[model samples]
Target: VLGLGNVGPLAGKPVMEGKALLFKRFADIDAFDIEVQARDAGHLIDVVAAIAPGFGGINLEDIAAPVCFEVEETLQAMLDIPVFHDDQHGTAVIVAAALQNALELQGKELGRIKVAIVGAGAAGIAIARMLRALGVADIFLSDLHGVLHSGRRDLTQWHKPFAVAPQDWDLAAMLRGADVVIGVSVRGAIPEAALPMLAPKPVIFALANPDPEIDPAVARRLRPDAIIATGRSDMPNQVNNVLGFPFLFRGALDCRARQINQPMLLAAVDMLARLAREPVPDAVQAAYGLTATQGLAFGPEYIIPKPLDPRLRQRVSGAVTVAARESGVARR
Candidate 1:
């Protein structure tokens, strides 16, 4: 089952329907999407409880942050089945994959990389935490209020874990020596002037939807060697959550996972990066009706898998379920 809050104009139904189709195709799991409205947490819980009997797991999508945090917490405490908020975790998983791939291409170890994230909201924080868990060195995060350094006076409890002591810094100063810069915030946060400050040929993932923090054309023009990606499909290295959710939920469903933990997410990321380095498999080739023996290659222009590329979910789901079983999070 899927639970969503106030899908605008019913335009969002197609997205849930697409998920259902993918679930049927890849995992053979049947899913129903429901639009929900609630004045408070209690209403959400009551609505979910009314329909919980039919679903093996619940996927929460497109809900805004902070409220999303509360909603997931409420559902987890109340429901017997596993509950996942795909926006928070799904986006994190795919970004983790992109980061890993970027690091690999650079011949750098994950532990030695210095990173900066431009957005400190749910997706940005989740990505930073997961990267830290994977042993990334020195991840600096900033939001609209500027750097999320320690004791800035406006820090929330959620942003506190990532707070560092202020260092008289600006975004360009932080980007000067960082190995990677990720943009999850608003457009044009990372100005073109900052492009040259990156640690010689740094990997840049400007992932804001519609318009990225740094314009892709501008970044490519200024620093011709930088690796760049965005959240839009028209651009190269599109880091769409569409690439993540179907496979991830498919894995959870296949294993009857009790939770979608860090280990499972990490596993999914690893496989996704590795898949981009090789040829598309027979099954995927047949599914896409393609005759090409070689799969998508990894490079500046192709840091991530295309969303329409049929090979993604099969490979990603297999890896995630394997990790779930190993991590003892799988019920099956």
Candidate 2:
């Protein structure tokens, strides 16, 4: 995986070890975590190639964006094994699922959805691309400067293709009348007032770490009819990437997938959204140990499944694996 910091107990090692463990639990897969002493892309590529023979697939984790885009592209070109940057694709899969369920609850369609991504970083770009593939034509991306538009002079190559030209530069302006507003940006970016400007029954995914762009309470108050989610575990609708990565990688490894193409990603999305809407099984309820009221149900507060939901890995992995096989990316 491409990631940050010198190898030590405090830094990137714990996450690597955790991912390795998740790999084992979900698919009996083995992984070696290599700490790149330098943050150089070339260095990471060399190290990955040196250890390529032991693995059937490559799972890239936690590498920052823009640079991550180059890294994923490079590794895919260099290695025979399917190279997947989990931060990008994994997050995309879960967001797609969450968006689908959110839209369904609000009685909206993907084609007409107007999405505003607060952060134009890795996760935001991936989500936008995936949403586009899902038939969302109206996507607006915002960075620290303002919303990315065609007239913006200071746009990066990665943000250029999805730029919404000549729109209001203010973030609040972008949120106005938006059907779906996703916050992958910094914490507390979406103030309480901004939430009220959303279209009725909007879909808001405030997916920043630790603290979200907007508090769930604030969002709920601003538009009670709106469907809101976050990256936090404490939140009711936790839009965690855990819903997809372990399973996505498992499927890719199982099938010896050559590439993680769009069809495979969409398949994973469909399966996860469908699973989220499934009748709560006795096993699932037993695992969570929550009451029928607190167990599995569909609403703004109870959208995505908890991490400990036992059915997640099997359900998501099965769909992704089948998708790979059908798309001819999987060898098995």
Name the best candidate (by TM-score).
Answer: 2
| Maximum-lDDT candidate | 2
Compared with the true structure, what per-residue lDDT tens digits does model 1 show for residues 95-188? 9888788777777778988899998877887888789888985989988878888869887777888887877867777787888999887788
Residue by residue across 173-286, what tens digits does model 2's lDDT show? 888899998988767888788877888889888888777888888778778888888888776788877777777777777778887778888988998888778777777777
Candidate 1: the clashing residue pairs are 150-164, 279-295, 280-295
TM-score of each: 0.87, 0.93
Off by over 4 Å in 2: 1-10
* Model 1's TM-score against the true structure: 0.87
Off by over 4 Å in 1: 1-28, 281-295
| Residue 95 CA displacement from its true place in model 1, Å | 0.9
* Model 1 C-alpha lDDT versus the unseen true structure: 0.78
Shift in Å, residue 297, candidate 1: 2.1
